[model samples]
Target: MAGHSKWANIQHRKGRQDEKRQRVWTRVSREIMVAARTGGGDPGANPRLRLAIEKAKAANMPLTNVNHAIAKATGTLEGMSYEEVRYEGYGIGGAAIIVDCMTDNKVRTVAEVRHAFLKHGGNMGTEGSVAFQFKHCGQLIFAPGTSEDRVMEVALEAGAEDVITDDDGAIEVLTAFADFESVKKALEAAGLTAEVANVTMRADNSIELTGDDAERMQKLLDVLEDLDDTQDLFHNAAL
Candidate 1:
């Protein structure tokens, strides 16, 4: 399994958003704006935009705010333009870490990201250094007690790459990034809901951190996540 979903990294990142309060909305808005500007304002025609909108909906974001974000992105209203940037690095115990950000100021974003790494017992790597350790895919996890047969039937029939049920009975559906939206719609239409759904860079392997290493790794991840430009983060550490 390469420990892809064992730690449920994306879900953990979302869970921790509660600590930052409004930062989740800010990150979601940035994603929405970027997706809109790049793919146009129509969610129907824009997969990325549609995915962003879905996340917004799941977060209970206001419709007015979603519309405002789209408008600003499409230039119907004024707003700062943002560009996506990624940083890869080695964290405590040499765990692979990837930080995703959207920023209008590349210099500031770079500095903030670099500073966090250096200050937290880590160092940034050149582009692609740690990226090869991950796969860019869509993941959907269902609750432990969800009907495994139902999930497998719908997800597999709808173009899922694989359906895996963990030892504890949780179901995970994997799909190619491009097929994510369609597969998700199919599952939901069949009355199946995922507990965690997103397109993410899942780790290929894991580094089990314990004691001092685990504590340090958590601190480093927290620092990187707290940066204003950070949109999404991934790591191989099982803390």
Candidate 2:
């Protein structure tokens, strides 16, 4: 598994405290809106929107809130227009980093991102500079108690690319981006629940970090993720 996926698992294991829940919901909502807008509001027809709705439900967001977001996306209500942007860079230890963002103001977002990198001992690079070091894939993380053999059987039957079992008993199923929805549905039909199901960037290689470099790198990632405009952050740092 990539470092980003491992880091996400670590965060999940910690569970959500009250303070982080609000911010997390905000980001999830944005993602839902974007998916609905791009692919239409019908979950039956829009795979991305379907996954977003599932995530919103898992987060316990109100049905009214979900409907309103869909309305905004479908133009029933006015909403701020957001553009999806990606930033590639290098963090401490020369770890390749990729940031995915949704912003109303590109200028402000880029400036803030650049500042964050500079402050954290990193620098932003051109669009393709670090993106080449990563591969886009669909990942579904199952909670503890999920059976590895069973999960693998269902996922592989659904066209998954790989299934990885971690020492902590968390199972990660990887699939082609286009096969994500089918694989997720197969798992659900087999009575397996996924803690997280989304399309994410996976690093092709990782840079090992220790001591001060590791600490500072984590701080940089925390700062980036805390930004409201930032949607997803990926890095090639090996924990």
Write one digit per residue (lDDT tens) for candidate 1, span 46-121: 9999889988888888988899999999999999999999999999989999999999999999999999999999
Q: Estimate each model's TM-score.
A: 0.93, 0.90
Best by TM-score: 1
lDDT of 2 by residue, 141-238 (tens): 88667888899899999999999886567788999999988898899999997877788898767787879998899888878776778888888886
Tell me the whole-model lDDT of each prediction, alpha carbons only.
Answer: 0.89, 0.83
- Estimate the TM-score for candidate 1: 0.93
Clashing pairs in 1: none
Where in model 2 is the C-alpha error above 4 Å? 1-9, 12-18, 143-145, 167-169
The predictions' CA RMSDs to the true structure, in order, are 1.9, 2.5
Clashing pairs in 2: none
